[model samples]
Target chain A: MDKLQRNERIGILMKLLTDSPGKIFTLGNFTEIIGSAKSTISEDIDIIQDILDKFDLGMIVSIPGASGGIKFIPSISSEKADFITRNLCEELSQKERILPGGFVYMLDIIYNPVKIENIARIFTRQFYKKDVDYVITVETKGIPLAFATARFLNVPLIIVRHYNEATDGASVNINYVSGSKKKLQTMVLSLKSLKRNSKLLFIDDFMKGGGTAKGIMELAKEFECEVSGIGVLIKTAEPDRKLVDNYFSILTLDTVDEENGIINIRSSR
Target chain B: MDKLQRNERIGILMKLLTDSPGKIFTLGNFTEIIGSAKSTISEDIDIIQDILDKFDLGMIVSIPGASGGIKFIPSISSEKADFITRNLCEELSQKERILPGGFVYMLDIIYNPVKIENIARIFTRQFYKKDVDYVITVETKGIPLAFATARFLNVPLIIVRHYNEATDGASVNINYVSGSKKKLQTMVLSLKSLKRNSKLLFIDDFMKGGGTAKGIMELAKEFECEVSGIGVLIKTAEPDRKLVDNYFSILTLDTVDEENGIINIRSSR
Candidate 1:
């Protein structure tokens, strides 16, 4: 087998420590991988840390005492985030995403890496700009975008369920008229969970009637928290009453007519 | 207003380049911001380019003889991502989430930065370990996880769509049974796309019934790529079939009953 070099060691070390949560490493065990001296490994570790710093991807924390080597935190800065959002907005514009009821069929473009990273970065930047403390979304579709935004901002995300369960006690519920359903329904955050005056960003997969977003707004107000902003994967070009104050989208489905073979899309970062 | 600090100046410089795309800037603008000398600004730009590599975010591209001040490419890499995953798994286990119907509410916690960062790191590490060339996911919910995974791996992502459109000329489609629909649904992917023999890690928001996963698996095979592994934000304790080959999950849902206020969560990440 070819002997592992410093660059290889750095790559392996990143692969190993990145998925970890704390700042502790087993140095004795770590140096065994490349079979290199601890001093040599230490120098490699330094250079590796420099590379990580360049990317704005947190840092490598070394533990000094025995049973310690290195760890990682989740971090990123704005300048280092160009490729991500730029790619997302760019690819999203390429889709012929047209569906009925102002819905967009953007499954293809949204999945691309460059776009996803950028979407996450842009949404997070907006959320942070608003100083949102947390992220909120309804079940199923909104989950992915919410997760990405939350990861970028390093904030907690809340998922609201339509139905009530015994496990989640004493919920605050609200209802309003919404798509087909006679009444809109939503559950409030568990009291004392997110603290009063907390700011949150509402995320959804697609926005049409705005009923779900309205319901989330009601839930946020019930918690005595503020709705910092809203974001979505796609928004219909046709205008509708927006429920939240501020929002952005990756793609706008200008129109989609299955029979006419007409689908229009434009990017919105 | 106070003058922008040197670090902030660098950030602003990156922003200008990112927003303008193919544009150049001269030292005069730098002088206006920090009141620094042209040479100082030049050195600052040099330091930025040298220190922050990969961020392909573009470069100083000094044109010695003419038409250039600076240009950027916009890129970044994953380096110090080792210590976040395990911590995320551990924090995820602590959520104590249990809801009926075997649904674990870790999605909320997974969105939480307290552990979400770790989860993202761990996921990225897995991507590198598997040497995945790309990250794959379905739309709506999977976008965020896919984005995070892609961000960590610094790879491209490809999203699969539920339905086909005329815009996607000459495509390949596959049918997989769905748990919610209880019927086979056709998912589409572009043909001759996704470099053949590319390594991919499939990620989703949640997994149950194994049908959706199997469908994703088939989608990858359609592209002539090898499935490196499978990952999910949450997984049902057990399902009738296993959709993934090698899977990793932050939390497992054991039971969920809407009426009994009963939910059980199991963790073995």
Candidate 2:
């Protein structure tokens, strides 16, 4: 391949780094691809970092040592996170979202790729420091958010399901009570999903009683893995206390006035 | 913000356009963000496009008209797609993945964020021209791949579940025969998940009898939507005839010889 210009090299670098967040790329690797000197590549990385800082996109972190290399971290600035959460609260507060039995219709936001990407960025910023080996979530609504978070963190995702299938092979099952409903439910995970001593980050779309989070913790223990971090998009305020104490939530749902058609939700911050 | 240099502007543009795939951005929008003239921004976009093409990252499409701008289309070149699919087949055919009952354990691959991103890029290249309004899939293994495809296509995802929940409000349920197992199963989707007369793309991790795809087609009909496309990571070769005639698959699973501990798989291309 011919040598690439400075702008072209920068463009390719930015695309490759951001596309696989947290994956390390040595300077030598870039030098080989772009045919540039180590010093020139280092200067290019500094410029990319400056541009990232100026735009509030993300940060480029350099690991020091023999195996060290630079990687992209999907961290959102606090101001930008605040703005995103506020917009989300506004969108969720719309009266039209209030559904029967006081349930706020959130499938639209939770399943939306663009919105989920932003939400997962916030979660990544919160849990990226945990050095999570895997991002785990219960099947259904939480899958999208958890998948996006796993992508941003450059880790594998594990989905625990309500039931086991033949395709899953041997599995481990645990039962836990729903936090709010107080209903018993079972969680299933494939035995081969995680490695022993792995650290997991539990991500979900909603947390009403934190039952699912607790269930995930119990399930993780069965595999000798640890739940290092927990993050959710929304949590209810009425519970006051949850099954698990340490968790990060983007929004707090104060109440859903079914009769009056009002949804009182706010940013957790 | 201070004015950005040409390379800096190109970096930002590449990051923004690729991050939110298929999202249109007007020249004025770029000018306001980068503090550059419209003509200069145009030139930056041209450079970014060339870089993207040279690297086979993706393409920058120009949409010209009122209420139109430029969008990034996540298209993988055929050579790259072939290389990825072949690598996938080699990894999947490992003897360690052969499980009991002739089932190949694939949760690790399907749930892997990096692998899913590459697989979804291939799917996006196939279906992006369909102008799909939504990407839908059934619960369990397919969620991650479907979510990634939806992200690349910049569309909302609709997950059809096996059971109903109150949080989904009123859902439309349909029963279909499992093509391989020949057992009847139900699929439920929220009534409000899709707008009427929308184009839908069904994505999954594996296809046996294509019963799930058929079920999805039936469910789409209930919502007055059309199943414009179907894509899966792997399909069984035994069923030379699938329930669904038109679908794209990345790999063909010829046989999993449980007795002899041999697996035969090949790239669909």
Candidate 3:
């Protein structure tokens, strides 16, 4: 095969990395694609890594050893993350956005591909080095964010459904009490969704009392999987006692003044 | 800002294009990002486009006009698409996948981020030039695919729920008959999900009878919106008369031989 020019090689490398985020490509892989010497490919990767770092887009990690390979980890700089959090807080703070039961109208932000993609970058960076086998989330609102995170992680996304559906087939349904409302809720997952002992990362659109997260943990346990980490877009500040601890959130909703049409939201930092 | 070298410019351009596929970026935007002249940026874009073409990855579309800009439309080559469709067909053809009813156990594929991402690129390319305001899908299995398609299109994904939930908060509900069973079905969408007369593209994991797609159209009608197009991963061949006509599907499931565990599937050529 003929070697690609420097510019073209860099272009293809970026495309390959961006196409399959969190996937590691061995030196042989790059050499085969670019038809260049290992040393030349290594230099090109270093240049690409440097440019990515300088732009605050993402970083490439090269593992040493014959069995090691270079991996691309998507990330947003602190400044960018903060900006996104602040913007999201503002967008979600509108009085009209507050639902009757204190839930915010976050469908717009959660479903917005551009916003979710940036947020996914931030979340993926958190578990980039973790041994996460799958990204899990409950049905409805959390699906998009979870899918985004899974895409960046290059892993399969497992969704837990709220109601029994014929399509799921042989699902494991578990009932749990909602932490905030103390109401019974049932979450179901297909028996074939995940392999046993998989390390799963749970992500959601919102964390009220961590009831859903706890339920997810329980569900993972039922499958003999472990919940490696929990991430949420927003966690209510009033929930001083959460069912699950050690979770990460982008923003904290302090107060919602429905009367005055005001909401006090702060970035988690 | 200092001008970026050719290699660096190409790398950054690929990242930008990959980050927000199907979205247009003005030449001025690229020039600013690369800190170079518009001509240089244009040349760089041309080179990237050529490389993408040579690799059969996707295409760079340049719209000419005062309001025009360059758009990155992600696509899978026909060979790749056919391969994906064939693999998915085989995966879905298992007798175990065929539920008591005709529904197939599709949670795995729909939730699989990598597969959905590739399928999404195909769906997004189909409507890249259309004025699509939102990518709509029903809850459960279709959310991930809808989200993927929306992500590629850089649009908001609007999910229609099969059952009413408190979280949706005052949604627009519609009733439609399931095309296969002729049973009544209800689908609800948040009233705030879309604006009046917004153009929507509906996508789903499976299209048994196109009933859900038809329901989506009815729900969109309540908001005075129009469904520009509909795309599905699998459409059963038995349903000669579809509830919604003129929809694109990647694969058509011809027959499910339960006795021998054989599924006759064909790619939509």
What DockQ do the predictions score, one after another? 0.14, 0.88, 0.74
Q: Clashes in each model (backbone N, CA, C under 3 Å)? A: 45, 0, 0
Candidate No. with top TM-score: 2
lDDT by candidate, in order shown? 0.59, 0.92, 0.85
Candidate 1 Cα misplacement greater than 4 A, ranges: A1-105, A119-129, A139-145, A160-197, A204-209, A222-224, A232-237, A240-269, B1-105, B129-133, B137-144, B156-199, B204-212, B219-226, B232-269
Write one digit per residue (lDDT tens) for candidate 1, span A25-119.
Answer: 66666666557777877776676565556546546656566655666544456555455545544544443544444344454444444444456
Residues B16-69 of candidate 1 have per-residue lDDT tens digits of: 443332245668765775577788677667656653342222234554446557
| lDDT assessment of candidate 3 | 0.85
Task: Kindly list the per-residue Cα lDDT of model 2 for residues B140-247, writing each as its tens digit.
Answer: 789899999998999999989999888888999999999999999999988888999999999999999999999999889888899999999999997899999899
Residue B126 lDDT, candidate 2, scale 0-100: 97
* lDDT (Cα, tens digit) per residue for candidate 2, span A1-269: 88778898889999989998999999999988888898888888998999899889999988899999999998999999999999999999999887788998889999999999999989988988888999999988999999999989999999999998888889999999999999999999989889999999999999999999999999999999999999999999979999998999999999999998989999998
Shift of residue B131 alpha carbon in model 2, Å: 0.6
List clashing residue pairs in candidate 2. Answer: none
Evaluated against the true structure, the overall lDDT of model 1 is 0.59
Clash pairs detected, candidate 3? none
